[model samples]
Target: MVREPSDRSSGPEEQEGVGEQDGFQRLWTPHRMAYIKGENKPSGPGRDDGCPFCEIPKGTDEDGLVIRRGTAVFAVLNLYPYNSGHLMVCPYRHVADYAELDDAEALELARFTQRALAALRKASGAHGFNVGMNLGTVAGAGIAAHLHQHVVPRWGGDTNFMPVIGRTKVLPQLLRDTRALLAESWPED
Candidate 1:
């Protein structure tokens, strides 16, 4: 089934050079410009020095993209999630190392991770998950000054050719919606 390209004059959006297109489909992700431009990245590691992990919890959960708040730790959506429901468990303290975490912070972090998985399972029907920490910048910690564990949900056939060949991730859900759903489903413990 060969579908011919429509005449460019049909609509302003279809005009040549108005937008880039692939033969099959398009994934326009303009919001990523902020990430690419490093818009909200912190200047330093200080607790009040603009680090996102440190500052995020201070705002309303919805605005901050936070899923749940614990005594010493919190769970929040990954601003630049690899998948739609990607989440991170982080300590409230501005400590960088996992070893730096006090017993309570460490325990709560673990609990949050568990709860995040449960919430995601209930909210999104996740088949599997990739949960771990990236210790430092060299090890893939986008925000290395704060200790955080990634909780990326996975499903069968989730990894497609776009990420492998085009270096692009296709997230089907909106971040705020994903956050709201997970927050609603988060265990009350």
Candidate 2:
């Protein structure tokens, strides 16, 4: 029921059917549909409302993709990463805003973030990093019920036509493998 563009001499503008050839091969990423449909996303602004950051620590490290755990905070790989080895440092307590962090939580969060960067560098040889928090829903926080700082690894020429023109990112490694590598590469206290 599908016809290639070469089947007809006419251009795409003249085609009329369900399978209209646009002259470009598609890179189907059906897995992205879960993210697009907001699966596993929290429904409310509470820990009891299925906050992933709150529940992640309860599971085993490998199951949760957690790289390192601190007294007040932990580092875990982002399920939908912007790049390979992209991880977030999150406080154990469920707090929506950065100002809500206490002295101990703040200190541990900072230390965990530093350790995340070091582990990423050692594990993947990341050239640079994009580190920051989205703050709130309006500020681009996917899970606005909990505060988390992202540490996205970047390399030279990492930004290419795939994400720019095609609106897709090509991650080379699996989340579990990346987590294990980062956990091993994490620095000592």
Candidate 3:
């Protein structure tokens, strides 16, 4: 038998013996919906096919959350970060693999990674770091069309039950603010 939902008032107190209150409080994060829905993720593997790494370099530093711009690479904050100061060093050229990078690109990418570590340490007093690349989708690269190396800053006991059990990471600062701080802390060449 098909039963129709009653047209009763939906308020918590107004509900008739339904939706019993639990002790848990909701930490509603509506912003995560965009990521969950894959809103800006690339539709195809081409540079012109909605690749964020290609598009990010075209905008101003502040708008793109870019910390430093080298000749062949740039450092930008991860839109969906694992930690507070997580950023990526990406080659300007939209190549999928690290082996595809030219000599200049590879050198600058390494230099930028070094600078990222220093800047993050100065800006946030990070105790440690998780730095590497997820080469492809199978390797856990979110945007596998472009080559980017992650520079995730870590502090002692940064991981907690929130991310383990609750499946949520609590970032204490905004991306823009973190960008500004890291940019200020970046070493001058």
Tell me the RMSD of model 3 versus the true structure: 5.0
lDDT of 3 by residue, 77-175 (tens): 999899999999999899999999999999999999999999999999999999999999999988899999999999988888999888889999999
RMSD of each: 3.8, 4.0, 5.0
Report the number of backbone clashes for model 3: 0
Residue-wise lDDT of candidate 2 within 1-189, one digit each (tens)?
A: 455556443443545654466666566778888888999898999999999999999999999999999999999999999999999999999999999999999999999888888998999899999999998889999999999999999999999999999998999999999999999999999
Q: Model 2 reaches what TM-score against the true structure? A: 0.90
* Residue-wise C-alpha lDDT for candidate 1, range 1-189, written one tens digit per residue: 434575333334454567543244445678999998987777777776779898898899999999888889989999899888999998888999999998989888888898999999999999999999999889987778888899999998888888987788988888899988999999888
If both were scored by lDDT, which would come out higher, candidate 1 or candidate 2? 2
Identify the candidate with maximal TM-score: 2
Predicted structure 2: lDDT: 0.91
lDDT of 3: 0.91
Q: Rank by TM-score, highest first.
A: 2, 3, 1
Tell me the lDDT of model 1 at 30. Answer: 83
Worst 10 residues of 1 by lDDT: 6-15
What's model 1's lDDT at 83?
A: 89
